[model samples]
Target: MLTAERDELMRIIRQLSYEQREVTLASGRKSDFYFDGKQTTLHPRGALLVGKAFYAALRQFPAPVQGVGGLTLGADPIATATALVSALEGQPLPAFIIRKEPKGHGTGQWLEGRKNVPPGSRVVIVEDVVTTGGSSMKAIERAREEGLEVLGVITLVDRQEGGAEFFAANDMPFVAIFTKAEVVG
Candidate 1:
């Protein structure tokens, strides 16, 4: 039987996926299909469902995770809601942000909100969508450079455009809540 949360998640995704004539992708490729993860992830119901789904998905990890985070912009809300609700649920996983570029002033750090994390903290990188795996891979690189152990990657949508294969080829465990076919078809 589907849990209440899982059922809600399916409803949110179905509601978010809509037909469009032309859509622009982050990779600058033109296509007749598009997925605006923000349309769901940013909504009240969507945020809760996504956070619960991610928490459930990552709970299978072999190691204890210090936190969850992802690249800026796309990953911002996902990480935020996950961290917040996870705490309320008493798991209390902190969230971090990986900047696309180092801040020009002040701390000038590339990764933020992880000051208390010691070296080699186990972390799971989160993403709203994984198309070619480029952005998620960059986030993984940045997390590694910060001395964090990457546990895996959790994406809301897998565009199935070679992203899952890319992660598997690199020996990285990648999980997604929805596939491109589920969204587009």
Candidate 2:
């Protein structure tokens, strides 16, 4: 269920991040418009709204969700926000950070914050934006390698550029809070 706060988050995203200009995405695709989700996700109010909304969304999963996370840099803030909000809501959701590659030193881990989560735990992967789904896919793969069961994926924005299709093709559940059309139009 969408709330006024979530709607306001969308509005903030459009106002702060969405832009009408040719841009190249991480997927190496060129588009007439772009959404730099970090701009909004990192903001104080935006983070609070995202945390509340994402926590609400995660609660809708048919199965229990023990944690939330995704690839770092983009997913970092979302994961932290969700976890913090979940804690405040009396349902603690630990956040994990999946590295693009394992660290070169100090335990050389691929996943940071793994200690908070146990093996075989159910987790929902998150992303700020979904394009080709490469980053999300990598995070899922890494989670599976660590014995985590990926229940579903959530993204702040879906570009309508094959990401949803990719998850469907791979038999993974996916949800997006907003879409490019919803924000840009």
Candidate 3:
């Protein structure tokens, strides 16, 4: 069962992120509304609520996940918040970051937090929003490349676009804290 924090996060998203304006999404699709989840994910109260809500939701996955992570920029704060909350709860889920491209210097790798989560660790990809699931998919691909097992995906919000179907088509388990309609409708 979800807690009130989930509802609070929705309220924050609606107030700060959701906007009924014509916008083009990262997926190149035109949308009637835009939800730049960073607006809330970066807020103090919003971050707290996200951590609490996502931790509660993460507990529902049948397969245990040792770490949380996803593509950078958007997923960065979500993963970090969840990881921090999990640690405070005494479970300590490590967080990883998947870069859009391999770093140019040093090891030139694609994923960060590698030491915290060695190969074969079970992890769930976390995202701020899900549109086409393309970004999360890339993260999953990179995770697999690093020998990590992807248990599933958790998103702050689902645009109710093709993301769920995209994940389902790829046989990936997915859960969203809020849907587009739930936040703005």
Best by lDDT: 2
Error of 1 at 145 (Å): 0.6
Model 2, 1-185: lDDT tens per residue?
A: 25688788988998998888998888788898888889998999999998988898896687689999999889999999999999998988899999998999889999989888889899999999999998899999999999999998999999989999999999999999888888876
lDDT of 2: 0.90
Residue pairs whose backbone atoms clash in candidate 1? none
Query: TM-score for all predictions?
Result: 0.91, 0.96, 0.95
Ranking by TM-score: 2, 3, 1
Candidate 3 per-residue C-alpha lDDT over 85-147 given as tens digits, one digit per residue, 9 for 90 to 100: 999999989999999999999999999999989998999999999999998999999999999
The per-candidate count of clashes, in order, stands at 0, 0, 0
Off by over 4 Å in 1: 17-19
Superior candidate under TM-score, 1 versus 2 = 2
Clashes of 1: 0
- Give the per-residue lDDT of model 1 (tens digit) for 1-185: 14877767767776784446697777777778666778888999889888888887777677698889999988888888888878988988888999999999999999888774566889999998888898999999999999999989999889888899999999999998778676555
Q: Stretches of candidate 2 above 4 Å error?
A: none
